[model samples]
Target chain A: MKSKLIIYTFIICLFLTGCFKENQIEKMGIINARGIDKQEDGLVQASLVLFQFEAQAKDITKLVKGTGNSTKGAINNANLETNFLLDSGKLQIELYGKETAQEGISPYLDTLLRDARVPDTSYMAIGEPTAEDILTVQESGISMNIGQYLHGVIENSASDKLFPKVSLVKFSRLKNDIGVDPILPVFEIKEGIPKITNIGVFQDDKYVGDISIENKILFNLLDESLLSEWLEITLPFEPFKKYKRNSSSSTTEKLHVALNTLRNDSTIRVTDLEDLTFKINLNIEASLLEISNQIKLEDKRVLKLLEKEIEKNIEKKYEELLKKLQEFNSDAMGFGSVYRYSKKGKPLTRAEWRKKYPEVKADFNVNLKIIHHGETF
Target chain B: MKITNVIAPGKRIRAFYLFFIICTVQLGVGIMGAPSYIFGYARQDAWISILIAGVALILILSVIIYILSQYENSDIFGIQVDIFGSFIGKVLGSIYIIYLAMALLSVMLTYIEVVQVFIRPTMPSYVIGGLILILVIYCIWGGVKVIVGVAFLFFILSQWLLILLYDPILRMDWSHLLPVLDASLIELLKGAKASSYTLLGFEILLIIYPYIDNKKEIKLPVFLAIIYSVSTLLITTIISIGYYSLENLRDSEWTVITLFKSASFSFAERLDYIVVMEWMMIVVPNNIFLAWATTYGIKRLYNIQQRKSLYILCSLLLVSISILKYDYMILQFTTIVSNMGFWINCVYPFILATLVFFKKKRSKHKGMNTT
Candidate 1:
């Protein structure tokens, strides 16, 4: 009797297992990328890059667009045009338009946070003018799906340490964290192709300004400790004129130098509490890669002079960038975090830090070491 | 009522299995959300709160073991009967049984709710609840030895999931843990009090004491188990506080599960989904042990057989889980159960241990006078 009961129970369980709603892969529209833009009339528009599985199709992806008052509403509006059920579980990236990002992204991020299906690792970026244009671009020489392609672009840059990787979770963490603001990579149509051109700075959730691509490495050096990479710096020709071995006359006013950085580490300290001043120290170990003016790198004195010049140049540029960020009222460098931790009393609030951020002063110290000038030098 | 239980020699288990039993029972649906709940009070100092709770747990476990040592082959129900006499002891024992039943129901409902939110939203609650209860009934059929075996097996199985926390640990912002000792003493105590929910299940030792073969050696395993469980909670809480900002931590419902959501592998993209499904191994042992305690208590207090009480209690739990389908309703039920569990599991033991101590002293005095 007990064996029979066990058999019956097993059979019942088998039958009950089919009660769950089945979602077949072919019948669902797998959303790879989502883009949101704000319209002039204050409505939200959503553009989704969906993976198409038709064997005969030349392209395996397509874009669907819709408009509504909210992000989810806009997505649901887009859902009406497709035969397959739209599923965002496979979403790899999310894009925001310049205007929409300027308005703020916290409202759109709510749906992402509330939904359990959306992965927190999905990359977040801002389109230069509008998310729809970037999502709908038909660039040549790109055979893969556009969404996948965009994800690869951002992922490569992040891995290379050229741009900070701001995933859905990281973005929210920085936005909500006291004494720190969020930064996102900005994409724009350069000529005919979509490209990540700059790093967008945000005050809270609003896009206030951007750091140009040329300054990306410097920005990264200030942001976090980085691995091996290449950096190009230009110095005054006057400093190295005497050391030039060939005495080659050049019309250029500045000497260009390229260094392959093996490692860069930065530390931020609150040096003065009353003056609200912070001191940033950078330690860089690099191998000389290129030089506009050939100098005797074999000489110890010349190498020391090169290091000193490079340090001074980097320090000057860092001061400029810090001033620019102060102007924009964005503490993307997380100076507030260091200040908050150093103080003993009450925790610093975001609003209080924002008010004090403009008056904050910083001193930059760069220690540059040319470990080796490659096999040539 | 008999004060000492007489068991078949074959039914007894080694004292070492208490480690597995206590550890598995303490780690349930509670640890998944314990970080967020405790973080609400202690902030980054939540680990300190867990440490405080651990020390208190060790003291309480020692006292409970002392009380059990005062009698031979006696469990909580038997000792209560000795101290409070028949009627009051039965009433108190029945209340404990009811608490266990409520705890069992809440665990089932919470797991169902998690499945609904994370995996299949449209699936009915009764299906999951009924399925789990069926497994519990099957396990309970094998008796206490089988329950302990399941606990040991599942404890070994579920420990590998701890390795998944490595990815989240890498992304942690060390600065978030700064400004330590920020929470006041009162707040830290309150945080420790909040952890009582997750730190429960060791109370099972009170009833399962009589079934151990080497009763004298039970202390080492039991203490080790509490330390293992508490340290696990402490580690997860510390990781969560560092991985998420204060505001983000506050917003997250299940911080540990969310931590897994960000972990991606080359072969598997959504690890959280796998973790959620694999969590059944963890949840089943909890249900089995709690169900065993409830039914065993019923059998001891009343004359009803364990099998009959198991079936009736499981059916009632199925009905309750189905009725408490809404998220808010499940949350409310969980709050009520944890509050009740706090008092019965943490506070009541000290009171009972004191009563047992004084009763033994008076009985010794009476015996001396009679001689």
Candidate 2:
């Protein structure tokens, strides 16, 4: 009995002396958002937007800067400027400057991939002009937590299909994937607030071009991300030109129609892999929300006309988008991935796909259905 | 020589604990990264690979249990002695113990690697290993009864994590799972071969056979346990395939934890931290049960006290973990052990069952001649 007691005491003492030296939350600089910029001398300037842990702490946001040849070195250099050990457990968003992103994003993102403490769901974006300047902005009117602020900017737009959802996990996976390229939300700081203005397109980890906000919805529609939302599209009021062209006080309000509960399905059929020709079918389902133009709701002819008009408009816009992607040799639409995984295609390397993608032609087929017209008179 | 103390096989256990013991032991560490292992080769067909592996393992496990039934309430250690005589039998027993210890070491180190990646990055590996080992040592010191009791309790508690998969399921894009049956025959064969190791730890029944009561009733529970674990793995793998795109699923090193990140409530930001910590309850039982088996082998072979063997093995595990460097090296170590275990635990049972069958026939003939 006495011997057992001694052994128990020895075991208890070991626990009392913890093997893990618990890192106190107070002594660590918890970074909220991080930004990286490339310099002319091949060094990177890392900017860390740190947040305090205390619930009622007065100064929650602090921007710290450091420069080094590599990302890890730059982070360590940034650590030197702070009084506490720097930590990235709470890192919410990572942004890269235009110069750094165009050169290649894989090198800057490698550290985040290697670090386990970093969350896979953290949002990533490309900043226009410079990421350091975006992180360094100090606005009294803005709610100051750049991490939450930037995350909200992207999250809100992503929900509306204006921006593609680009988390670190998807970014890392897409960069390594041969067929599908990665697309990250790109932002430009405007009027003291960051705005998601364009979608940055990457082919094999290097940012080559961007799709503007005007084309983002169309891209997202083809990508099937525009499902379960309302889309407002404007046409040139074709009926008005026929009816009111002779009137001196003619109103020139374009035809506006709201597509509600919108959903899209895309099918990529590889036809003749030797010829590098693929056919894509996009079928969309939705209900009409509002229409600014007065059209006969009971007329089957008008409904057909409306469907054909929307399909033609989408086909034209998608053709323009496809032409740009092919010119850039970017498979941001994942057409090559769909082709490679299809039953009748041979395996192709990313370089080979890049070469073949420029020559690949897609024939678009759009099917549209409007289930509800909102109690039309 | 029968073990007379509390750790002995004489203390009868319910047949149901067999279900939880196999489950708690096999379901740890591997399930978290199961998708990543085969996703690269199988692509979106990773779930189908998991299903194929599970069926093959169930067939193998049934054969192992049937062989144990032939020996009649005697565990594999005694059966080894009965079949090969004392000298050769004890030698084989010692080799199995070493194999089990290596398996235990891999599971422990993999969990420590997880802690390093997801839980505490700054803390040293040995420290996490030491802390978890201490909990394991306590369970081992209490004997098989304590290990079985904890396994049952942890299995029940950790099951709620299945419900959490619904959040990721809500985001499932069914089109990602298209191009079905695209994996060639050779790719699937290799995938099944790699998955044999993940289906290990059911062989724990070989060591724990004597303790379970109702010898005739054990088969049903064992079958249930296999079905439960197989379906659980299948569900997670299917969820992984549908939730993340094939391009992303292939690179998801921590598949389960990454899935949990998509599960968010209104109040919480990082849901993975909370879900991952709960997995400790599921992981610790694996270490304790295997550690106990290692010591049991030592006591039988060398006639040493179980306490002394436990101390030596725990210290050895601690020392090994201290020297482990880098994340990939931990992965490399576990992969090597798991590959070796695929041969020893998964395939060797079938071969041993055949040998045991021939030995049983000869003994029966000798008894008939005496009659």
Candidate 3:
């Protein structure tokens, strides 16, 4: 028993020694945002916006800039200037300036992707003016500070189909993908606040253009509902009257109904029957939030007119989105991915899919249903 | 006339020796860069490929068990010699030993590259490489039973890391798995071949077969050990896909490490540092085992008696190659290992199995002719 005890003690000591190490950094500084810029001498100037917590002062936002031949070198240089280590594991946003992003982002991104220290889920954006300029934007009022606000704004807009939520990992993936181009929420300085303007599209390491908010719905059709709230469209008197009078089911001559979007479900299927094409099907369920008090609750004629208007509106938007995407050659909606995934029945390389994507057709079938009605108009 | 027998089969191993075996084989070169490599070919479908590979591995393991069980008192080398003529069997056995040694060297180089790329950039390549090789040599200077025992313990301790990073998986977007069947059949098949890389370490079963003391009941533990390793791979693959889309996964080198960077806890801000530290825990056992295996291979092939000399020689070879000019050698080595190692682990075994089965049939016919 005594011998066994001695052996156990020896093992425990060995395990503890392995666990404990010296020269460890106790206090780690968390960087909220990073700004990347390319210099003329083939070096990179990195500006890291780190938020430090102190007992007496307001949250200190320190701008530490470093220049080096590579991202790691720049980071190490910056660390020399700072009292604490600059860690990016909790980094919220990464802003690449228009010039830097154009030079191609793969080299700069290598540091983030290769190192286990950078957070992959961090929001990535392209900055106008410059990333340093965008990161410097700060003001009082609004929901949060510029960095936090911009982070929320992009995340919020992405869910609302107002902008694309491009993340570090997603950007990394698109950087090499041939058929699809990369998209980042474009951050523009508005007064003293960072504003998410539109999605900046890039093809072959160059910025092409931005996908406007007007065409966001088309992209939304390719994604799951990031926004759960219903959309209410006021009934146009001419269309409402035409449908009400022509329909046979209801006695009411004029009725108004507002549709609240309850759910949006979509699926993309690729078929190679005649031409390479992708078919999109939308399943949207809406509740009637408001209706004319004059219209009876059971008015079939009013319901039919509401359905027709919804269908027509969706179809028109779908065609507009398709045309815009084709014009920009933006496969962000993952029509290209859909085509490739479908062909997994027989897989093709990225080179093969690129040749076939331009000739692909897009067909949309939208089913809109009014599942419920409000208590009062 | 005397037939000399220097050593006998069925030598007993201490329970602790199992840890070395489990750790060395389980904590392999796969952890550093598997997610990125597999993700390149399969994309979001990489996780599915990993899952399929895991199931396939389990089936292959069953076949190995069946063959190993056919001979209770002999090792794989002995069984080969018994099943086929001495000359052909030795040739095949030599090929297997050479493959094992090359794989050991390749894994050592890959591990050194990962450390250079991520952990210690300013540290000289030789120092880091030499340090790891020294650690492996120190452990391997013991014996096979001791190495296997240490591997088992190392494998157990390495699992603690999953608990630390469990919360980070919640943020993973499973939609990354969409359009699951998008790839052509050829692409998926190629992806499956790529996926076999992570599943290759189980081939150690063939080499370690002779040393197991409890022949009748050793199957369950060995099978469970393999399943545990595959399960770890599957979980990590799914988490990687969810964290990074297929497009992003292709660009990254260390998907699992990157996944940890996405993780944060209330107490710890950067979980990746801890993950990297945990990686050391995994690498130690793995390096020691591979080094020991290579040492054993050299000793067996050349009929060398001085085992320590073999250990030192194998360690120096690994350290030298690992420190080779880092530009394209590492990449070339990775590509060779992934591509060639696939055939060695996946294709060569089936070939050997077929030949052995045919030889057995021929010998049986000869016996019948004598009757």
Candidate 4:
């Protein structure tokens, strides 16, 4: 009787295993990125890059657009137009239009984060002008595909430390975090080609402003220790200032010495707890990447001059950026987070910190060392 | 009245299965959201709570081992029958058996809740819960040897899931762990108390002790198993704390599953699906062992066959699970269940052990001979 029961159980198991609703590869509209923008009529326009695979062939790409009152509504509207049901299980990135980003991305992020199907590591960025237009831009020669292109642009820069890796998860943390705001890589169509040029800075989810690529590299330095060589600095020195055979010639040509930082160590010292004064010290180790052929790297004095000039320029630029941060009342560098989390710093609310930020004093110090010269030296 | 012959099957478990059994049973649906629960009480110093809980568990488990040593060759049911007369002893054993069934219910319901949340959201809860029980019944049918074998296999295989934390570790903000020692001593104590949920399943060893072929060799492996479990909890707690801010972590449910959403691979997506699914392997043993314990209880108390008792238990379990099908209530009921488990498993084991000491000194085998 027991042996018969075992065989009967196995027979019932075979019959019960058929409830799974299989998602076939060919019939699924695999979404790679979803772009959300606020339309002029105040409706939320959502767009997606849908992947369609061919049997024994390369997959074809398609775009589906929809406009509705909310992100979920817009996605449902887009689903109406597609043959295969939209599956966002593979969503690689989420892009927001500049205008929509300024309107705030927290709403769209709320919908995405609520969906267990969405990957938390999806890259987040603000597309200049509008996310719809940016999502539509495509090129085959430069990029393998638009999603790969767009994702590669941000992912590459993030790894290079030009911008922080602001994913849906990290962005939500920064958004809800008391004292710190978040930033995202910015993309714009430059002469019909999509490019990630700068990062849009936010003050409490509002796209207040943006920093240039150079300033972003410096901003990233303040935020975290980076091992990258994307930081290239240009310095003009005396040797190339007047490269004529005779110094008396009085004709001067600039020696544009370019050095890339190979490694950087940044530290924040809360010098005074009362006024929230901070001294951000950056120790940079660099190598000569490019130079005008006039100056030689073998000369230690020349390297010293270049290092000092670069350091001085970095300090000046960083101070200017700090001043700009005060102007915008932005704490994207997480200074407020640093202070709030620190043991001794007095805790304050987000509004109070933002209110007091303009008056908070910040000092900048950059110490650059020439770790290696170019291939010649 | 042959205690060892009744519990021990022809195919006995080796000492190594003790390590995997203790570790596997320790981890389950509780780990899915344990960090947040512990953090809710202790905040960033929750890892310290796990350490304290581990130390306390070491002392408590040693006490249990000492009690087992007092009984020359007996399980908890046998010991109860020896200490008390058959009528009262049978009643206490029945209560204990019901407690194990409730434990089986709680474990099954918790995994069902997780499955609904992460995987089959639209599927019927009864179907999912019933399917899992079927698998548990299959494993339980294989008896203790098969159950221990599954635990051993899964313990070695599931260690790789820890590697999924690499991406989150890279992205984590270590400052979140700051303000260390911020939670007071009392809060840390409450945190340790809250941690008892995840640490509760190890006491199943009390029932399965005699089946251990090398009882003498069990201590080092069991101690290592506790160390393994404690460190896993410690590291996962620290990782979750450092990965998400305290406020966010508290606000977030299923701290571990939510963290798995961030795990990315080149070939796969939504790694949480993989995690929540592969996590079933770890949870099944908890159900199997508890179900076996209840069945083993039936065999000991009423002198029925183990297989028949399992069918009755799982059938009754199916009805109970179907009745408690609502997710929110199950989630709420879990805390109550864990508190009860803490009493029954952690505190009461020692209490029973101390009772054994008193009963032995007072009457010894006098009650046994009369029974």
Interface RMSD of each: 0.8, 3.3, 4.3, 1.7
Q: Which ten contiguous residues of candidate 3 chain A have the minimum total lDDT?
A: A19-28
How does candidate 1 score on lDDT?
0.88
Worst 10 residues of 2 chain A by lDDT: A241-250
Residue A146, candidate 2: Cα error in Å is: 3.7
lDDT of each: 0.88, 0.78, 0.66, 0.79
- On a 0 to 100 scale, what is the lDDT of residue A250 in model 3? 52
TM-score, candidate 4, is 0.91
TM-score of chain B of 2: 0.94
TM-score of the A chain in model 4:
0.88
Candidate 2 wrong stretches, greater than 4 Å: A1-28, A53-59, A138-141, A158-161, A225-228, A239-254, A343-345, B2-10, B39-49, B166-186, B235-254, B300-303, B324-336
TM-score of chain B, candidates 1 onward in order: 0.98, 0.94, 0.87, 0.93
Please tell me which predicted candidate would have the highest TM-score against the true structure: 1
Superposition error at A347 for model 4 (Å): 5.1
Docking class of 2: acceptable
lDDT-based ranking:
1, 4, 2, 3
Tens-digit lDDT track for model 3 on A4-112? 9999979986786453333233345567778888877888888787766655447566678888988778878888887767777567888888788877777777777
Model 4 over residues B214-267: C-alpha lDDT tens digits?
777878888898999888888889889888755678877788888878877779
Supply the TM-score for candidate 2.
0.89
What is the C-alpha lDDT profile of model 2 across A230-266, one tens digit per residue? Answer: 6667777765444332324536568777787567877
Give candidate 1's TM-score: 0.97
Compared with the true structure, what per-residue lDDT tens digits does model 1 show for residues A244-321?
877666656798999888888889899999899989999999999898877889999999999999999999988888
On the 0 to 100 scale, the lDDT of residue B163 in model 3 is 82
